[model samples]
Target: MDCDLLIIGGGVNGCGIARDAAGRGLKVLLVEQDDLAGHTSSASTKLIHGGLRYLEYYEFRLVREALIEREKLLHIAPHIIWPLRFVMPMPPTGRPGWMIRLGLFLYDHLGGRGSLPGSRGVPLNGPFGAGIKPDIARGFAYSDCWVEDSRLVVLNALDARERGADIRTRTRFTGAARDAEGWIATIAGEDGERTVRARAIVNAAGPWVDHVVGAARGAHPERPPRLVKGSHIIVPRLFDGEHAYILQNLDKRIAFAIPYERDFTLIGTTDVPWHDDPAAPAISVEETAYLCASVSRYFAKPVNPEDVVHSYSGVRPLFDDGSTSASAVTRDYVLKLGEENGPQILSVFGGKITTYRRLAEHALEKLAPFLPPMGEPWTDREPLPGGDVGDFELLLSEIRRRWPFLSERTSWRLARAYGSRVNRVLRDATSLAELGEDLGGGLHTREVDYLVTQEWARTADDILWRRSKLLLHVPPGTRERLERYLAR
Candidate 1:
């Protein structure tokens, strides 16, 4: 097979590049060794906002770009991305009240705040104060967004596929060699090894960026990515409202306690220096204790290690800028373009989900000389797959109206997950029975079929974890049942 661009790694960066390039009329081929977003992309804090913490590091350009992208993304994918108000509890000794206010002012004005609301002072003594201790009386609230992170990757891949890009998850780009004409990539899938040629190659292999670069010829870059491990824990809901809380730790690191999966609260992300395998990193007992302690400081109800129901850890492929602290490392991406004469390779290093689209746009521009003269950049205003609906609630209402038999929970799930594509899954199925077998935990045959057929889901984990986040809610036997069904 031959294409204009071949992307390695199916994370946000790779998928985003594929979507953008394909939209610009480039024949794109993307291959991932494991499931799409099987690593860092899925295990994020899942926030779309300017890195408020980065202000201390003077990352003004990075923060401003991310903030602008946040609003643009929310507009394009309203179903998957919505405004989230983050409540930050102020500590007297932390940064001083004046500094906090000044930071919020900068955050609000840094980017042109479009549809999302700006920051404001809120009294923590009221309903939001229930979980808080008496010392912290007031805090500031700022607007960001919550994204279905993994789903965002899938939707981008889906859009890329619809636009004639080949997105092959579970396929590895084992090796590649460049010639005068193009790069010949050795792709290994379940079927076996095959060769695909492309004029240019995009190495967006999140954590394994260096590993992928070795496939060609030259040694890795002088400044490689320092692997930083960030872990999150899921416990029973800590606070009541739909809002999330950003807790400040004694170490000056920030942790988020966001409402997740309806019944649970997602607390996370300890930035620890990591050197272990990037493919799979387990949360240490100490890290769990740290997260629990971080949230316990702010909430009225204390959280212990035992309270954690589920936890996840991922290694961020951050560009090593010689920052002493892992938290201090910049989240801004570094796109290094390869040889000027030979088949080009653009290696992406260090990026957050909030800036993936802009990163994609930049990636294409970097490779513009090698690529064919194609369409203009068009991903900005265009919606991702199933994001054409005006609003999430309106789409949910439409689902319920069309299928009155669907319970509120079911409709809401379908509307949020499938977005405007809900009708495609619900096609011709008038009643619950017609929707087919229940594999347990609200997942039905209709939805499973849609995922398997349309979304390139080959395993139960793809549907359960990345596609829908039903992994936490599903029963013990849910995986087995889904696996058995797939086998047939």
Candidate 2:
């Protein structure tokens, strides 16, 4: 196959780039070895924020860019991204009130303040302190965002594909050789090995970026990616409100306890140095204990390792800035455009989810010289598929009006998951029975088919874990039943 850009990664960055490039009238090909967001991207803390703690590292530029993108993303993908208020409790031993107030002040003004509310000091003795320790009487509240991280990635890929980009999931890019005209890349998949021709390449392979660079260029990266493992744990609801708590530890690290999946609290994340396989990173016992301890320190109800219902870990490929500690490394992205050896190849390193879109824009700007002429940037102005539904509450009401058979929860889930595309998933179905057989949880056959046929969901895991967070809510045999259906 021939294309203008060949992207090797299916994470948020890769998919975001593909979407932007394709919308600009470029022939884009994005190849992923597994399902979109099957790795680090799926395992994020599920946040779209300006990395509040990053301010401590003096990453003003990154924070400002991220804060700007935070509102922009919320504007474009309102269904999957929404504003979240965080309550940061003041600890006796942690940074003092004056310093924190200054930090929050910078945070409020950094992004040029948009629709989201500014930060404010709140008494922890009131509702914000419901489950917090009584002794910790004061704190601050600030705005961030909650995101369905994997869904964001999938939506970007879907948008790219709809824009005429060829998005191939479960296809691995082995290597590529440069030539005068462009570059020829090798890719492997279920069909077999094949070669593709492209004028330029983007190595947004996330954690495997260094490895991909080594294979394609026959040399390791000059500044190899630093892999830091971050872990999160899910437990029963920790507190009674829609708000989330950001707990500070004496060691200078912070952990969050956010409301998750309606029935659970998501507590995370610990920064631990990792130098092992990036494919499958598991939370160590120590990391789990640390997370529990971090939150337990402030909450009126103590959390223990035994209370953890589920835990996940992901290795972030950060730019090695010689930071002595893992938590201090910058979260800003670096676009390395290499044209010294041959045709141009841009390798992305050290980026957070909040800034993926900007990263894509910057990447295309870097690669513009080598590739054919393309259109001006437009991804930010338009909504991702299913995001056009304005006034989410009205949409939810309309969905419930149309499908009275669906429970309130199911209706809300469908509305949020597919947005305006919910109708496409429901089609002419007017009753629960018409929706098709129930798999488990709230999943039905109609939705499964839509995912498999439209969303590149080939396996049960893709449907259960990545396409949606149904795994945490579904019953035990749900996977087996879904797997059997997919096999047939």
Candidate 3:
């Protein structure tokens, strides 16, 4: 396949770049070694916040950029992105209330605060204290956004595909060589290997960034990425309120317990030095214990490893900024344009989900010298696939109205997952029976077919876990049945 750009990796950054590049009228081909968001992208804190903790490290630029993008992202993908309130309780051992107040002030006003609410003091004696200990009385409430992180990646890839980009998941970018004219790339997939030429290449390989660059250029980065593993554990709901909590750990780091899936409290995230493989980072015993203790410190009911129903871990390929602590490293991204080689290859190092769009804009700007002049940045105005509906609650109401046969639960799920595309998925199905076989996990054969044909889902894992968190809702037999249906 001859293309203007060949993008490696199917994580958020890679897909986001592809969507942007394709929108600009570039012939784009994105190859992912595994499923889209098979790794780090799927295992996020599921937050689109400006990293309030990064302020302490004096990462003002990163915070501002992320905060600005937070509102913009919410506007474009309102179906998957919604406003979330975070309550940070003050404790006797943690940072003083005044210090936190100062930080909140900066966080509230740092970037241009848009539709989302700003920071304010909240009395924990009320409903906010549902699971918190009585000793913690007052704290700060702030605004951020929650995202179905993996779904966000899929939507971007879908948009890219629609905009004339060939997005191939389960396909590996083996190697590439630059010559006097453009470059040649070797890709291997189920159908085997083939060579393609492109005018330029984008190495957005996330954790395996340096690995991809090394395979192609035969040179290692002078500064290797510091792989930091972040882990999260899910447990039964801790509080009845919709708001989430951000608790400060004794080690001065912060952890969060967010309300997830209507029935579970998603608590986590421990940052630890990772030396093991990035492909399969697992939550260590120590990490789980630490996360349990982190939330237990503030809540009345102690959360231990026993309470954890599910856990996951992912390694972040952060730029080695000489930071001693894993959590303190910069979340900023860098675009390295390869010169002296034949065709220019841009290798991306270190990026956060919130900044992926801007990173793509910057990436394409870096490649301007090699490719033909493309159109202006248009992603800022375009919505991702199934994200045209701006008002989520209204969208849900509309879905219920249009499909009177849909149950409230299913309507809510479909609205959140597919947004306006719910109409396309349910097509002509006036009854549940017409939607095909129920997979016993709130998953129907219809949804599975949509996932397979439209969303690039190959296995049960792609649908149950990444495309949707039905894994938490599905029974053990759900996967086998779903896979059986896919086989046909």
Candidate 4:
């Protein structure tokens, strides 16, 4: 196979690049060893906000860019990306309230925050934050956006496919050799081995970037990718409202407890230096205990390991910054273009989900010199697949009117997950009988079929964990049944 661009890695960066490049009229090929977003991309805190904590490190440029992108993304994908308010409890033990207020003020005004509301001081003792402990008397509420991180990756891949990009999951790039014309790349999949010719190559493999660069056949040694591990835990909902919380740990690190999947709260993200292989970064017992303890300090209801419904860990392929502390490492991305000895190879390092779209735009800008004429930057104004809802509430009402038989909860779920694509998924199905067997909870065989046929779902995990959080709703036995069915 031959192509204009060959991107390795199916994570958010690679998928976003594929989408942007393909839409620009380039013949693009994206290959992933595992499923798309099977790694760090799916394991994010799922926020599309400017990093508030990054302000302390003086990452103004990155934070400003991310903040601007937040509103842009919300406008483009109202169904999946929506405004979320975060409450930061001002405890006497941590940073002073004045300092936090200043940070919030800067965060509110740093970017051109148009559609999202501005930050405000909220009384922690009042009804808005009554659940918080009395010691936390004051707090600040700020705007941000929540995203289905994994689904974002999938949608980008889908959009890329629609724009004429060859997206291959479960396909591995074993090696690549630069020749006089371009690159001769070796790829292996379930079927076997094949060679691909491309004028340029991109190593967007998160966490595996260094491995790819090192494995490139006859390529000069490049700067190694620094790997850092971050972990998150899932527990029962901690509060009654939709707002998320940003808590400060005694160690000065910040953690987030965001509402997730209707009934559960997603708490996370401990940054720890990781020297192990990036492919398998598991949550350590110390990290889990630290997370529970941090939440327990603020909430009346103590959270323990037993309360954790699920836990995940991911390795951030940070660009080597020589920082000793993992938390101090940069979250910004850097693109290394043109190889030391041969055809151009672009390697990406250290990027967050919130900036993936911008990262793609930057990557393509760097590669424009080598490629032919292409389309202009169009993603900033375009919506992702199923994200064209002009008004979210109207979309919800339309779903209710169309599926009057569906429970309000089910209708909301379908609308949020599929957005405008719900119509296609439910085409020609009038009644509950046409929806097929109820696998469990709100899941039905029809929905699973739609995922498999359209969303590249090949296993139970893809449907339950990546495509949707049906695993938390379904019975344990049902998962096994679904797994068995898919295995056949």
lDDT of 4 by residue, 305-396 (tens): 99998888999999988888889989999898865544778899998899999999999998887676899999999899999988889999
Candidate 4: where is the Cα deviation over 4 Å?
218-220, 340-342
The TM-score of candidate 2 is 0.98
Off by over 4 Å in 3: 218-220
Each model's lDDT comes to 0.89, 0.91, 0.89, 0.88
Give the per-residue lDDT digits (tens) of candidate 3, residues 209-248: 8888887862335466889999999999999899999999
Which residue runs does candidate 2 get wrong by more than 4 Å? Answer: 218-220
TM-score of each model, paired residue for residue: 0.98, 0.98, 0.98, 0.97
Candidate 1, residues 137-235, lDDT tens digits: the string is 998898899999999999999999999999997898888888888888899998999999999999999889988888865323546689999999999
Question: The CA-based lDDT of model 4 is what?
Answer: 0.88
TM-score of 3: 0.98
Q: How big is the positional error of residue 202 in model 1, measured in Å on the Cα after superposition?
A: 0.2
Best by lDDT: 2
lDDT score for residue 117 of model 4 = 83
